[model samples]
Target chain A: MKILVCISKTPDTTAKIAFTDNNTKFDTNGVQWIINPYDEWYSLVRAIELKEADASTVIHLITVGIADAEPVIRKALALGGDEAIRVNTENSDAYYIAGQIAEIAKHGQYDLIFTGKETIDYNGSSIGGMIAEFLNIPYVALATKFELNASKAIITREIEGGEEICEVELPVVVSCQKGVAEQRIPNMRGIMAARTKPLKVTEPVAFESLTSIISFELPHAKAGVKLIPADQPEELARLLHEEAKAF
Target chain B: MPVLIFIDTAEGHVKKASLEAICYGAKIAEQLNTAAEGIVLSEVKDDLASLGKYGVTKIHHVNSVALNHLDAQVYIKVIAQIAETTRAKIIVFSNNADGKAIAPGLSVRLKAGLVSGAVTLPDTSKGFTLKKTVFSGKAFANVSVNTDKKIIALNPNAYKIETRDGVAEMIPFQAAVDDGKVKVTKVTKASGEIPLTEAEIVVSGGRGLKGPENWGMIEDLAKSLHAALACSRPVADAHWRPHNEHVGQTGIAIAPNLYIAIGISGAIQHLAGVNRSKTIVVINKDPEAPFFKAADYGIVGDAFEVVPKFTEAIKKLKGIA
Candidate 1:
């Protein structure tokens, strides 16, 4: 089986999300960049699990970014992928990025594709569905478990009220969510091998032009919490009804 | 120009998020001085005409037997074709399950400028700028669409639905609709009195409840107030609760009117999922728990003792024995 896992660069979870340039662009100042938590914790490890299940399986990693992202791509290889490819381009809005991924997927002709549910940076969960649409493949989002049986794949997704189990043919797209798997640290030997592994850097495939960012702003700070005395149930009731209006 | 809003339905009925989309499309239609029309697939239980009050000028029901279940690819094709036939310059969707899956697909096919998680109406004064959430509700961003046709996936509960007395004209749209390739042989819905997403009041428990055996207090409280029951990620991971009950950054994102958290430590991930709740009440024995920082009202007490008393108090207040 041929498996392709998609990864993106995002700010660490602890980074305070802020924008600069008069709120026109994200303020990456003092923010540490890392593989998106979703991709690292779920997609990459899950792909490694697939490789372990069958030693003959082939795994490749594709990213859409500049040469600066090469280290992260290498890190992914150290985690498990056999090779990696980077489409040298700066990250943009959902539309433009999906166009780049779809362009790559067209020629790669892989049987399975995986991406994180949404990037921690943009929080736009549009990539997997957009690529699936572009490739005309079956797509599932927020999958927790998958069981591949030759040509058929059984997948269960975390829906609003309960889990949704779906069965589909191969060449499917899945957006890995949390609880799929745990993150793994790359070992020394794998890291050394990753440095020598074939890392292909190519130009982007042209698609439609991108929509532009206008402005950004942080949410207003919330009010301080009010402590309702444990013994004053009547006061709590009155406060909830009169002041909070939360009945 | 016309507007086509895709209405998501389950068990042959409309979902709550669809109502908000109907309201949004109706208002946008009012702004454009055009009629707002809706496209509904098969198996809807609600009378299609009653939805007219939400500001639609027309209701288009495809009424296909083959379209009984949702297939993202099929819905994309159907909605895109409707836009072409109806000359819809703007298409609206509720950024819920169905919309999230299909809107991106439709955008790809039609090559329309697409924006998901739209929080407000577009700034039509200068082309079209849609406001949306970025970084998982930590910040907001505005995006501009230069394309002639725009597709917007409005976030659930982003815009309020206002109703007036006016009936929309019902028109059945004619397009070459193809059969769906995927089929849903069965729908095994969770048997619950209240669905967490649709509930106004949510009572959630974390690892504090101790075990699954002690979940009765949580259920009793939910039942007393007609609220939905929820849990934190740890509780679900521990197998004390179903994974569906888990609500956090990695779990379900919900925004109810009142969110009551019991015994939760309030990690940032968990808070990211539910900070939008209009009111939050936290009951924990630890006075310094991080959950209390975000809670609108904090009560320092044990859940076992406080919850039963709280339920009884609410029952007494409502005069329910």
Candidate 2:
């Protein structure tokens, strides 16, 4: 079985968010980049688990980013991805990125594709569905569990009130979240091996981007907290009612 | 060309978030000097005409049982056909779970530019640009959709629901339904009075609460506030709470009206999920817990003592027995 996992580079969770260039671009200065937590902790690790179960399973990692993303891709490779493909592009538009990944998936003809539920930066939660639409394959979002049964895959996804278990054939795209797999740390030997792993760089295919960021604005800072004494818990209630009107 | 809104329903009733979507679509329609129309694919038990009060001029009902459960592929196919038939220039949806599943695929099918987690109405003064939360609510971005057909998924609780005094015309729509590729095997509904995503107020706990045995205080506080229950990642990871209750960068992201955190230190990962809330109240024993910085109201005290008192205080204020 062949599986493809999509990885994205995002600022670390603790990074201070800021915009640059008249608010048209994210300020990357002093920002520490890491593999998006969902992609690494759920999607890529789940793929690695599948490979561990079936040694014949080949896991290929793909990223749609510029050369700066290679270090993050190498980290994912150390997590058990056999090879890596980079669609060398700087675009942040969701459709364009999905299109690039779709182009690669079409050529690879992988049986299964995995992506994080959403990127931590964009929080769009749109790529896996778009990729599925672009490739005309079945797609599932917010999957918490995935088990393969021969050619059919059983996936449990989070729905409105609860969870829904669904079955789909191979050649499917599943966007994974927590509960799908446990987080794995790379060993020293794995890190050493990842340095020599094949990292292929390819140009992006022609595609029309549907959206563009015009500008960015930071959220208004909170007024300093109103510290109520432990004995005055009722004051919190009074303030929530009369002042904040929270009810 | 009219503005079309997708009405999401559950258990045969329209969802609260969909009402917000309707209001948003209606306001957009007024801005464009066009009519706002809604389409529902499932068998809805609610009075479809009453929804017009939310600003929609018409509602198309498909009345199909197959759509009761979400099938994104089938939904995209049907909604695309409706958009084409209605000549809808713009489409709207609540960026909830179902919308997240459906809107992107529909955008690809229609070749329309789609923006999810929209926090504001489009600014038609220039081109079609609107504000949306990005970086997990750390910041906002004004995105422009240059496509003739545009899609916007409004973030839950971002837009207010305003009702006017008009009834929308109900149109019985006809469409062919196809079998979906994915077959649902079983469903397990969460046992909660209010689903965390749809809750207006949320009360959450963390490791500082000690263990699951001490969760009663958190529950009492949540019950007093009529809020949904949530937990920090460590609590969920330790199996003290179900994973569904976990809210953070990697878990469920929510934007409720009020969020109350007990014993949580307000890690950046946890804040990413709930920073969009309108008001935040933090209760932690540690005087220097990071959560206080993000909170509108905070109490530096032990949860065991403060939470019960807080719950009683709320109950007294609200006249709840």
Candidate 3:
């Protein structure tokens, strides 16, 4: 089985978010980059587990970004990807990125495709379904569990108040989240091997972005907290009802 | 051309988020000086015409049982055909699970610009700019859609529902129904308790609660407030709570009216999931817990001592037994 896992580089979870150039671009001066946690801990790890179950399973990693995304992709490789494809581009629009990855998936002809539910940066959660549409295949979002049998796969996903189990044929796209797999750390051997693994770079396909960012703005800061004395817990409730009207 | 709204339904009932979507679509229609219409594919128990009160003039019903459960591929095919037939310039959806599943695919199929997590009406005066949350609500971005056809998925609870005394004309529309390749085998519904995403008030706990054994106080507080229960990532990882109840950047991001955090230090990751809340109250023993910075109210006291009293105070205020 051939599986394509899509990953992206995002600011580390603890990075202080700020925008520069009049809020048109994110300031990368002191930002630390890492593999998006959902991609690393869930999508890529699940692919690694699938590969472990079947010796013939091949896992290929793909990302749409510039040179800066290489380190993050290498970290994914160390976690257990067989090969990597970089659609070298700086555009981060959801449609443009999905189109680029769809182009690669068409050529790769993989049986299954995987993506994190959404990138922590964009938080759009749209790419997986867009790619599936572009490729004309079945798409499943927010899968918490996945099991494979022969040419079919059984998947379970979270809904509003419960879980729904689904079965789809091969050549389907699935967006993964937590509960799909546990996190894995790369050992010394995997890290050394990743340094020598093939890192293929390809130019992006010509496509126009349907949407453009006009500007960015920071969320309004909260006013300083009102400290209610520990002894006056009732005052908090009274304030919630009278002043804040929270209830 | 009218603005089209996708009315989502589950268990034969219209979803609250879809009501918000209808109100949003109506306001957009008012801005564009056009009519607002709706389409529902599921088997609904409510009178379709009654939804007109939410600002829709007409509702196209497919009345297909196969669509009761979401089949994204099938829904996309049907909605795309409907959009084309109606020549809809704008499409609206509630950015919930079903919307997240359908809108992106429909956008690609129709070659339309799609904006998810929209928080406000589009600024049609100067092109089509829409405001939406980005970076998990840490910031906001104004996005412009250059496409002739545009789609907006409004976040749940981001817009208020409006009602008027009007009945919509219900038109039965004919469309092909296909179950597609994906088949749902079984469904296990979480019973009774309110789902976290839809909860207006959320009470969450973290490791400072010490162990699962001490969760009774947290439960008592949540019960008194009639709020849904949530936990931090560590609590979920430690198996103290279900993963679904874990609210953080990596878990489900929730935007509630009021969020009360007990013993959970406000890490940036945890804040990302909940900073959109209208009000926050933090209770912790440590005076310098990071959560205090983002809170609207803080009480520096141990949860064992403070949470019970807080619950009692709320009960007294509400006159609950």
Candidate 4:
């Protein structure tokens, strides 16, 4: 089985977000970058687990970004991607990135594809489903579990009220979330192997992006908290009713 | 072309988030000098005509057994046909679980530009510019969608629902349906009566509550508030609460109107999942707990004493037995 796992780079969770160039661009200064948690912890881990189960399974990692994103792709390889492919484009539009991924999938013809539910930076959650539509294949979003048997697979996807277990054949796409697999840290051996792994860079297929960011604004700073005395709990109720009006 | 909204339903009733989507679509239609219409794939038990109060002029119903569950592939086909039939210029959906699953595929099929997690109505003054939350609600970005046809998945609680007096005409639409490639095996339902995604108010607990045995106070507070229950990842990881109750970056992300967090230290991961909440109240014994930084209201007190008193106060306010 050949599986393609898509990864992306995002600012570390603790990074203080700021906009530069008169608030038109994200300020990367003094910010540390890491592989998006969803991609590294869920999607890529699940694909590696699948490959571990079957010795013949092959896992390839793909990303659409500039040279700065190569470290993130290498991290995925350390976690267990056999090879890496980077579509040399620095577009943040979800549609343009999905187009590039769909083009790569068409060339690879992999039996299964996995992508994180959404990147933490943009939080679009649109790429996997768009790719599935582009390829005309079955797509499952927020899949929490998967079990494979020959050419058929049983997948459990998170829904609003419950988890839906579905059966599907090969040549399927899944957007993975937590509970799909336990996160694995790369050991020294894996890191050494990743250093020598092949990472092929290709130019992006010509595609027009449909969306562009005009500007960014930070959320308003939180106001001074109203701290009701513990003894006056009834005052809390009054505040909730009249002030917050949350009820 | 009219504006179309996808009204998601569960247990034969229209979901509350979809009402917000209807209002959003209606406002967009009003801005564009058009009409707003809704399409439902499930068999709705609610009076479809009453939905006009939310500003929809017409509704299209296509009830089917297979439509009860969300099949993204099949929903794409059905919704694409409805959009074509109505000649929809803009399609709207609540950015919930189902909408997150369906809108992207539908966008690809319809060849429309799609924006998920849209927090406000599009600014058409200069093309279609949408404001959306990014970096897990830490910042907002205005995106310009340069497409003739557009798809928008509105954030669940971002827009308020407005009502006006009117009756919607129910229209029956027919289209060729397709059973998706995936087959259902079995479903495992979570135990909470109120789903976390749709809950307007959520009362969450943390390890500071100590153990599962001490969960009664948390449940009492949640009951009094009529809110769903949630827990930090540590509590869920330790099996003090079910995994379904977990809300964090790796758990279920919720955007409720009010989120009352009890005893949680407010890890960045936990905040990422719920920072979108309209109002946040944090209760913890330690004054230095990180949650207080993001909370609208903070109470430094012991949960054991504070929760019961708050519950009693709420019960007295509501006069509930």
> In candidate 1, how many clashes are counted?
1
Instruction: For candidate 1, give the lDDT of residue A106.
Output: 89
User: What is the Cα-based lDDT of residue B269 in candidate 2?
Assistant: 89
Model 4, B5-45: lDDT tens per residue?
A: 99998768898889999999999999999999999997778
Per-residue alpha-carbon lDDT of candidate 2 for residues A1-247, written as tens digits (9 for 90 to 100): 9999999999999899988899888999999999998899999999999988999999999999999999999999998889999999996689999999999999998999999999989889999999999998888989999999999999999887688999988889999999999999999999999999999999998888999999999999999899999999999999999999998
In what order do the candidates fall by lDDT, top score first? 2, 3, 4, 1
**Candidate 1 vs candidate 2: which has greater DockQ?**
2
Worst 10 residues of 3 chain B by lDDT: B189-198
Better of 1 and 3 by lDDT: 3
Q: Could you tell which candidate, 1 or 4, scores higher by DockQ? A: 4
The residue-by-residue lDDT of candidate 3 on B1-321, one tens digit each, is: 999999988788888889999999999999889999999997899888999999999998998888878878899999998898899989999988889899999999999999999998999888999999988889889999999999999998799888999899998989988768889999887777777887888999999999999999888888888888999999999999889899989998889889999999999999999999998999999998999999999899988988888889999988995
Which CAPRI category fits model 2?
A: high
Q: Model 1 residue B194 lDDT?
A: 64
Cα deviation in Å at residue B145, candidate 4?
0.8
TM-score of 3: 0.98
Give me the displacement of residue B283 in model 1, in angstroms: 1.8
* Regions of model 4 farther than 4 Å from truth: none
Candidate with the greatest lDDT versus the true structure:
2
> Which ten contiguous residues of candidate 4 chain B have the minimum total lDDT?
B184-193
Go through the candidates in order and give each one's C-alpha lDDT.
0.81, 0.92, 0.91, 0.89
lDDT of 1 by residue, A1-247 (tens): 8888998988776677777889998888998888887888898898899889988888889899998788788888888889998989987777788888888888888888999988876667888888989898877777777768797777777554556777778888888876677768999998999989999888987766546778998877769788876765455545655687766
**What DockQ score does model 2 reach against the true complex?**
0.82
